[model samples]
Target chain A: MFKRKLFHNAYGKTLPYLLLIPTFAVIILFIYWPAVSSFRMSLYKVSPFGNKTIYTGLSNFENLFKNPDYEKSAWFTLFYVSFTVIATIFLSFILALLLNQKVPGSRFYRTLIFSPYAVSPAISGTLWSFLLNPVVGHVNYFFMKAFNVQVLWLTTKPYALYALLFSSIWKALPFSIIFYIAALQNVSDELLESATIEGAGTLRKIWKIQFPLVSPITFYLVIMNIISSMFQSFAIIDVMTKGGPGGYTTTMMYRLFLDAFAYQKTGPASAQSVVMFLLMAGVTIVYFLFGERKVHYA
Target chain B: MMRRYKKPLVLAAEFVLLTAISLFFILPILWIVASALRPSGPLYTYANPLTLQTFFPTTVTFDNFVHIFKNLHFGRALLNSLLVAVATIAISVLICSMAGFGLAKFAFRGKNLFFFIVLITFMVPFESIVIPLFVLVKRLNIDNTYFALILPAAGNGLAIFLFRQFFSEVPTEILEAARIDGASWIRIFRKIILPLSIPAIVTVIVMVFMFQWNSLFWPLIATHSSRFEVVQVAITAHRSTEDTSWANLFSSAIAGSLPPVILFFFLQKYFVRGISGTGLKG
Candidate 1:
């Protein structure tokens, strides 16, 4: 702390603290306070009219558990998070591997591939919904021509969930690809040349050299993708499915949205938020605890 | 040896693989752009038959774009999004960089605790607490204003982390020399440090701008009126379950996505930097 005195004669002791004030003010007011209050808010009974509150501890959690729809939402969230995160990361890893091939026009290919990074999930839903429209969808048209079967995409159950999964993975793919490409670029040519000299083949090199070299980023993407899938699905579900075909696509985040915004179940929604916070924050915490230690690379 | 080992057939196969993957990513965007440029029609007219028309409109027109701006008030939505983004970037860069500067240049009591809080805020995704943040913002009577949309995001932990990481690398000798030259703290920061922080500033701007531009959920909840509607909200507005307006939707979606796409293209390297700047670099 003796280094603090180097510039202190001019900076004044309070300057740093003064500079930090706005950041703290915003973080406290917007993030931490709200997070802390959500736990407290989950416990109480809150009226929809914003006029009443009762300290009914744990009832909101009880009600959420009792609701079968909540159970389905939880199940869907599990699948959605797992599928979207894994598929996006895995597929993007392969795509990055392709781009890292230094193929002709790699720069153009990289730019085109990551363009969807700029598209909002809401807009992605619009684009995907248009692409997957039941009667006119090119995907369905191709299927029909190949197999002679009409497949309903957005209007059907399980298919709607599939739509959510597909678009979400597509929307989320570019982020992982960009990160993975960056990661892959860090794999040294010397290492790869040595591996090639040792008789390692293409797939083997990717699986062994490049993959392990990028595991830290893969882990980062895992945590980030898990967090994003929870929220980003909200927009897609809102636009493409609207949690439709008997709410098949409604994950916990979307369910929480509906309960809070549409149905005005503030208490239960708060409980759901608290539950999701614990689950997701638990992922982050575990990442810090173990994933960081295990995955740190040269 | 790595590039030489590939046979002509394998190289051709990799080339084909790259082409197919590129098409997979580009088709949806191309479809939207194609549809957006079309004159109004039955929503599915060119989408089927797997024809060339599916990829290109017969009569290319600016009518859909004109229609949304002329009738649907999409221009207002664009303005709203632009305003929010600018405000967010302005406030975010200032406060986040200031916090970053504080942490980087100073060693103070409670520094570890403060840094830990900043870390925790980012580690927790902002979307998780929307329900309660709504409550807090409502109580503060700012829920329906731009403040609600911009303020919460302005306190971005990632941006602050990025700036702190960057600022730590700046030589202390310059700061100390500037102080010795009788430059006050504010002058030192503005004259000496801010110019040196152009890269960090641009990265933060790009990060904040993209986050604000592409945001839907927070704006959807935090603000309620058409007066406060953002680009994402306006685009989604066309997708109502009842008779959906596909022309307006396509037009608005394309228009809304342009800013970030253009920004990414121009600042592609910084875009990569921002991604890596999120506390992970490979």
Candidate 2:
């Protein structure tokens, strides 16, 4: 009887494992297997027929680092990620705080603020490209009429990055605002009231009490912004500029696209991808190491 | 006495600032709509100013919409996107929810290892895996099929994680009672767990639907023919070729973006809850 009970108990405990098999199969087949293959491919050399898999012995990595285009792509990616994250966070924090107030039409305001989040990056990037068209764009038309300035928004060197940044921040701000609003709502009302009772001004209460409470959200937003800026902004660049005006906006992922698909340098592309993965993983690890301790849950 | 006025003044300032910001966000969308309707001369002419005339074309018609469908094969692409998205949502939700249920409610050895594996996959960006995935897809001879787009995206980490987090919140006693009453595991899932988890299931469906609908890169690489092209790829093709009509291009873009926006607006409460609830945990 004891042995029978033991067998039944073991079967009961193992049932969940049976249920998880499909998910594990998917991960192994799609994610883990691909990741492992990519890593292995990075170690070899691939050719056009795709038949020649010569062992490169770290030559791909050496080639990747040696190429000046890689440096340019890296710099552009850094600039894009940092600018978008900072601007999106700053603007969304202010918007979240403002919308959190008991103002009339607040619901409408919240919806309007979040409206952009629903639009896909591809569509939004196309729309913004049209809007920022140097010759026919409404933005330039208005500026030319008002200030008599026809700035080449997508062509000029430094301004090109700014245009991309503007488009990215516009797309990302609604998401950040939504997150911040949620985080702000979770802050204790008593904390804010006590700050007020201590003779604190609005700015003081926000700085001393509210900002600290929302730091975790801010950190998460930063990480998301970085990831999105790295991987997803390729669409924006593809649509808006095609990494154009002499490759001024050729981000790392875009360059990876060029190398693998356009240039047919599959081996180097795989190598670059591994490097990009390590960079992103390193950043995320650092973020978690420092930020995890500071995240306070109520 | 002065403090009362200060409050109203601050509120007025906030109102003004917020309205201006909202206008900034809304103007581009409004311009897209306006440009789509504007007449021939103003549509292509740089010098022509945006005016009340621009807002309403002199000959107001559905020329843009009709032209996109008639000229650009956008109808086919839209249909393809709808098929892929719906299939993705159905398959993903079912598979992920089952996995999530297992992870959340069941006590099994190696559970933490499996959960960590899911998390690692979640963190690894698709860009890292796209090449190998392409090679795999090619080897399997599934390239250019709808399966190329749907299958890889169906078992994503985000949906699994979202469902698991939600399933964990469900009470265990209910499942226990169902089991005691001689209900099978699959039966408990269907009758007890699923019925109680409709909110989360809807949330996963919407979220996964959005992701699949907007997906571009994988489809761009995987699919070879225009017939197999999703809406996003169609848009990119329209932009790249330049021979395609601008009115048609803009109209297709507008149409492609409308479904999600409308769905989100109608089901915004659930959408917002899903985002906030999932985002906080992440």
Candidate 3:
């Protein structure tokens, strides 16, 4: 094997290691070290500034479990992650199926729909907040013109979470659409044609052929949306709702952010991150075991 | 193309569905651009009535854009973000591609172990680790510096994966021939490998640039000074204050988002390929 490596006899004994050092150094310092530190810090009540610490053991976790806010955050995070995963997969699959129809102007539609993936969350939040503003906003303006009533999208309780849901789904649709479109395109023309020859209707063909072929991507997207909702929702919550009316939209990650950064409660924050890291790992493991088995090469 | 004969009505319905979905994606972007272009005023003036002018400024002005770059130091923020992204790309591309080449070509000690590390890191969401990373960054006394902002994200495991996949396909014959001709491995890499790896390099560049440009959380914690404020953080500033500056907010968000959008338009193919390449096989 060494003889058949890039150089005969594998002459460059140290070159590969040298090439790998920078990459390994970075992950060790930034990823692995921090991960281990997060596990460590959860056991100690570190001061906000990191200038003080006490060995508090599992008390921080006990406090986290006891905190009403943490409970609320966990509930919302569950709701948010579930809704986002299901909705994005369903909606973007529709968009992708439509785009895959070879519709006239499909290219134009594809370009516009997939453009949002390029948008930053900060900008997305700003635009959504502006559009969903209770007064003098287009959404309300149209609602008022059509229905004669105004809804407080940002300032109200249930509406704020729903508003976030809308914006986040809007932001996420393009990404999933891109993936689904790719997956749909990968489904073979021969199988589709055979289905057509067998008198299968579009819906029948989609349900039978397209759906199974794209299941892997759907599963992949489910994992992605969950990870995104769990950890990457800071800007959206920050700009649009500020986790607000009360803490209605605060996911556990946002709760952790607030505790660690805003409130200086480092121990509970570390515990929250530990939970997040495990949740993400668990989801990815499920994807590997289940979703990987569902892959259809054709 | 799998073009099947369908009723024109069905075709029309598909067209309508496609167009409606496209509008949902386009209108918000148009709203931001239009509202930013409108002459500075209270947002209600332009937004209240659903007229044609709601999405198209009656009097187009660059003043909002100018005002941000001039007064708000958005130019500096743009520079900072660009610097950080470029610095990251520069460092990331070299290291990841090197690791990619190394792993692709070498049957070395701990190869599988290193590959496992890369896979694990790639599988882990970077955002989930930010708090811990912040702790590490603070501990190292690099908090609130460029080092903190750029260092953590500089070595991307996915980019290495992409490069490894790409490099594996490259034939070993050329390198062996070059070695026989007295070419140093580094020289062979520069001459043979780098030139042949443009597509992989482009993919990594796009990947790194997008991540760096769009990141808000790490940058939020890693740096605090106004001087180090990135475009996303600067955009957040537009809304954080009690008196949210809608004009500046709209303007800076538009300006800040342009770089990645432009990259998407120009390198559309790579962007799509990068998406498809992420873990799941498309």
Candidate 4:
């Protein structure tokens, strides 16, 4: 009996760790190991065949910065992230607010609004490319008829980025809207009721009362949108513009992809990955710092 | 009197504005679907681009879908995608749920530290390590196989975190009762916890399924062979080859997008619930 009791005690102690092994094994092997390897690879110039690796510390970084197209790509990435994040948050916030009002056909509106959430980024890119293709695109067709303008929406500088931005926002908006509605549902209705009784108008009630309550969701969306626009929109860019008519729509993530595969510069691509990782981590840290203070004030 | 009159007018204005905005959101997606069914003719051959025909086809056919499925090897790509997604979902759910049960139901040394590590891993976006992951997969000799797609994404920290949050909420008394009945931990977990955690299981399944189904980047590079190509990557490949035909491109895009959209239609409640559960909280 004592031996059995000891066995039971030992099993109790070991079971949790035993359960954790598979998850941690995968996380360590695939996630952390790869992350560390990428950082190490950045410090070397790796051959395509993986047999030759010359350690050249910081030169890869220097070359990346010195390249002119890299400069434009970085700038366009920041520009693209800002536009899509802001547009998605703003537009989705409005939609969420309307949905929260329990307007007519709220369920219908929600189903429609959330449909884009399931669209693969590549497919979204494909659909938009079809819509905006200069020759057969109905958008261009309409523009020609209405304004007598034949704009190259995807093949021109700025316009290509704009088209990418539009599609990015369109795809991301559903997520933010759904998130905002969920957050809105948790807001205490009594506060809104009192605000209404105090004669706070619709705009005032939403802007002053509800917005502050849902600021956490706003902060969350900001972080998510930034990360997604930076990283996950790779497929969209690849499908729509293939990094552009003139490298105009190549974000940093897309640049890394091209450098890695198309250009076969693994080491430089690893360097690009390190830079992007740091940038993303830095942005998240700054946002959390600000969000903490904002939440405290709330 | 004036305020009362102003109220309805404001409501009317808001109704109109929201309806218009919803249309703005809906029309483009509708246009994609309509264009997919369009006959293989030039856009000019149809009615004006601004007309209802742009969004509602006057003449429709499934030839584009047939052409891609039969000619472009899309049926195989669809099968490959399903195999990957289903396999990933099965693996991640099992791995994550086991970890979640451990974290939620057991107290052990380093438990907090383990959870903290999981949380930290959650913040590390997959993009940063994707390049090296390709090399690692090649090193493991899994490149271009379903294993390449499945293994890397299987142990998702977010899924584990979500499941842990869920399992924590299951009443401890139930487990205690099972313990008193001399039921082993695994038996109790299988009999009591698993059955009770259906919502959580569904959430994880949907989340993982959508993610693997919609995934594009790694799949694009991981598999050079069409035999292993998933739908999203296949769509791009098909597009390049059939670049001239807007009809085929639209059809293929629609085909690639349909499964997840259809999945959403059936499982939207769980999707919304799962999304909300994972979303940020004050």
TM-score of each: 0.89, 0.89, 0.88, 0.87
Choose 2 or 4, whichever is better by DockQ.
4
Measured with DockQ on alpha carbons, how good is candidate 3? 0.52
Computed on alpha carbons, the lDDT of every model, listed in order, comes to 0.82, 0.78, 0.81, 0.79
**Per-residue lDDT tens digits of candidate 3, residues B180-224?**
899997898899988877767877888789889988877877888
Regions of model 1 farther than 4 Å from truth: A1-16, A48-50, A155-157, A295-298, B1-6, B104-106, B123-144, B168-200, B224-227, B277-279
Q: Is candidate 1 or candidate 4 better by DockQ?
A: 1
- Which regions of candidate 4 are displaced past 4 Å? A1-11, A47-50, A66-71, A145-147, A288-298, B1-11, B70-73, B101-113, B119-128, B168-183, B187-200
> Poorest 10 consecutive residues of model 4 chain B by lDDT?
B1-10
Tens digits of per-residue lDDT for model 1, B1-282? 445656788789988888898888888888888888988888676767997788777889999999999999999999999999999999999999999999888877788788878877754545557777888899999989999998989898878877886777678899888878988878988998788777678778987898899887788888888999999889877877778888888899888888887877787776565555444554
Tens-digit lDDT track for model 2 on A1-298?
A: 0111111233387777777777778778878888888888888998778488999889999998999978998998887888888888899999999989878998898887787776779888887887788988877888899999998988888778878989999999988897788778878777777777778999988887888878867887888788888888888888787887799899988888788778878788889878887887788778877776666341
Q: Which has the higher TM-score value, candidate number 1 or candidate number 3?
A: 1
In the order shown, the candidates' Cα RMSDs to the true structure are 3.5, 4.6, 3.7, 5.1
Error of 1 at B39 (Å): 1.7
Off by over 4 Å in 2: A1-11, A48-50, A187-191, A296-298, B1-6, B39-42, B50-59, B71-73, B171-184, B187-199, B241-244, B279-282
Model 3 stretches with alpha carbons more than 4 Å out: A1-16, A47-50, A296-298, B1-6, B102-109, B122-145, B165-199, B274-282
- The lDDT of model 4 is 0.79
Worst 10 residues of 3 chain B by lDDT: B273-282
**Model 3: per-residue Cα lDDT over A1-298, one tens digit each:** 1133354335767888998999999988888887777778889987656479999989988988898988888888888888988998999998888888876778888898987777888788878887887777789988898999899999897999899999999998988887788778778899999888889998999898898877767876786687677666777888898898888888877777787778877778778877777776677777767665566342
Which prediction has more favorable lDDT, 3 or 4?
3
**B190 in model 4: Cα distance from truth in Å?**
4.5
| Candidate with the larger lDDT of 1 and 4 | 1
